[model samples]
Target: MKIRCVIIDDEPFARKLLLDYCSRVPQLSVLGDFSNGLDALSFLNHNQADLIFLDIKMPGISGIDLLKTLGNRPKVIFTTAFAEYAIDGFELDAIDYLLKPFDFPRFLKAVNKAFTSFPIEKPAISLNNSPQEDFLFVKDGRDLVKVKLNDILYIKGQKDYVMFITKNRKIMSLMNMRDLEQDLIQKAFVRIHQSYIINTQHIELVASDKVRLNNEYLPVSQTYRLTFREFLEKHK
Candidate 1:
């Protein structure tokens, strides 16, 4: 799945540069761009992102202060003109620190490190001979919850966890979307985008660029559009 990212830098040129750089990376998606930490923090309260490109020296709230406000923080990479904040950034367990005037190659190196550190390990499962298993158990915190495949409407991949969106509730599990896709493909689940896997049976509409699953409008990226079209044709 592409990493959803937000860029927060006080300088307009800096934000634009990061946005342009992110566009060049296939695995990175710019979800929001902000000139200050307050706006970025507000956006995070309602939306989810996988990674953040932050500036350490903002006027009101520093990048370090913003990190402190987050409860379930995403991976962060500090971008600043000063080198002194590198130690503090690392102390907060940031993925990487980039000094201002950094080149594309340097930005890419930091991103690569973030991707490498993200956990996408496959969970252990003993499947039956049947290809269509009705249910499976996933680890959620300290509990092993049994989830019925039929109950799931779609699966949204976060950085390290996949959220199982069922008819009545959402279950968060520590699992990789790619591994889950392999296991569930035989049961009629189709990956319409890097970040979304939909139960074909629940797909309400298929547009040229998006799929409608009930009330949710999930994007169908160019990478998977042709395959999704074929799936629709066969099932229709």
Candidate 2:
């Protein structure tokens, strides 16, 4: 369920930065990049893309103009230095507007907004584990600790980092929630809220608004409640 995306920016450095950010999220697949709107318009016309990270101002054609020319437009997140174009971008129903020099957290916020508008399909459940591939490394102080997927009781996002809570240890990693969600969703991890991802294997009780895991009640936020309930219904 990767979001196939294209980057359209005149600046090489901006394109590179967006590409790097997109790479970190396992759900995003970069299809192409272009330095000008015309070239991007051509590529988009011939191919299908789910999302676009577009610069508002570019030579030959502005980002707004390029979007207008397209008959079938994908979801767009406008990235530019200009503040004046923000109103216009939103008028056209852009997913988000990222000011130039935005950091990873800001970029991730915009991406999360896009997900709300265009939610990806639920991942296939895979709770079974293999010795070699069922584990992932998380940074804890100076150490990269190996935490088995099945051992993770739940994960909590705090600011720019997420805490991996297992039975014996709580490992903290500098990772965003969106990237973590995509990484663990296939392994029977379900996002109950913007701040919580719970391992389905550890569910003790499911209430109307909260799920009990390891004697801890975690909220199932409105944004994620529908999908989480669907997961439960399918498994039941």
Candidate 3:
């Protein structure tokens, strides 16, 4: 299935560039393009899209602000001329951050990363069925690496990619934190912060504002503190 997409940018050239690039990828289909966040938000209220190409800087409502208003967010790729917004975009769980004046090859790479995460169909979730089935295959660069869920200590989100922290090795993949969270939610993994998700089995200690795993300390943000506490109570 082609991924339905929309473009929101204040610059006409940027919008046109993305529209042209979307056409070159057979996996992508353009649903609409708007010059402002409000129009795009209005359209998205009634429409369903798989992806959004958003600009960070805009009049009235910025792309970051628009993301806050979304109830069910589509995969977002932030395009901007400024590099300063990269960290902010990643914090918002964007699929990819594209700097301005990017070539087709770079654009294609970003779209491919998104496609890798948001496939037409997801694999069946049978990881909890048996000990032997409790593993997942993640793309690490050009290779797919098999990681046992039991061996995972924690998962860390670094910008657009996530690192699978295991007992013996750390595997980094081109994936968003949100997408990885969905895949591992049923496997006893919980998000402790915007940048950290830990395997409850490996938790060494729980503190007021952070969690300890082995020798590392991971913060438990207010956003997830209550949920984490409830989880602790239930498990106890």
TM-score, every prediction: 0.51, 0.64, 0.52
lDDT of each: 0.83, 0.85, 0.84
Runs of candidate 1 with Cα error greater than 4 angstroms are 120-236
Comparison by TM-score, 1 against 3, better one: 3
Error of 1 at 234 (Å): 41
Best by lDDT: 2
lDDT of 3 by residue, 86-135 (tens): 99999999999999989876786688678877745332111344665688
Show pairs that collide, candidate 3.
none
Clashing pairs in 1: none
Per residue, candidate 1 scores C-alpha lDDT tens digits across 1-236 of: 57889999999999999998887665678999999999999999898988999999998899999998998899999999999999999999999999989997678668767876766323322233345757777655535677777788999999866898988988886567887788888778999898999998888887899988778889999999998889878877
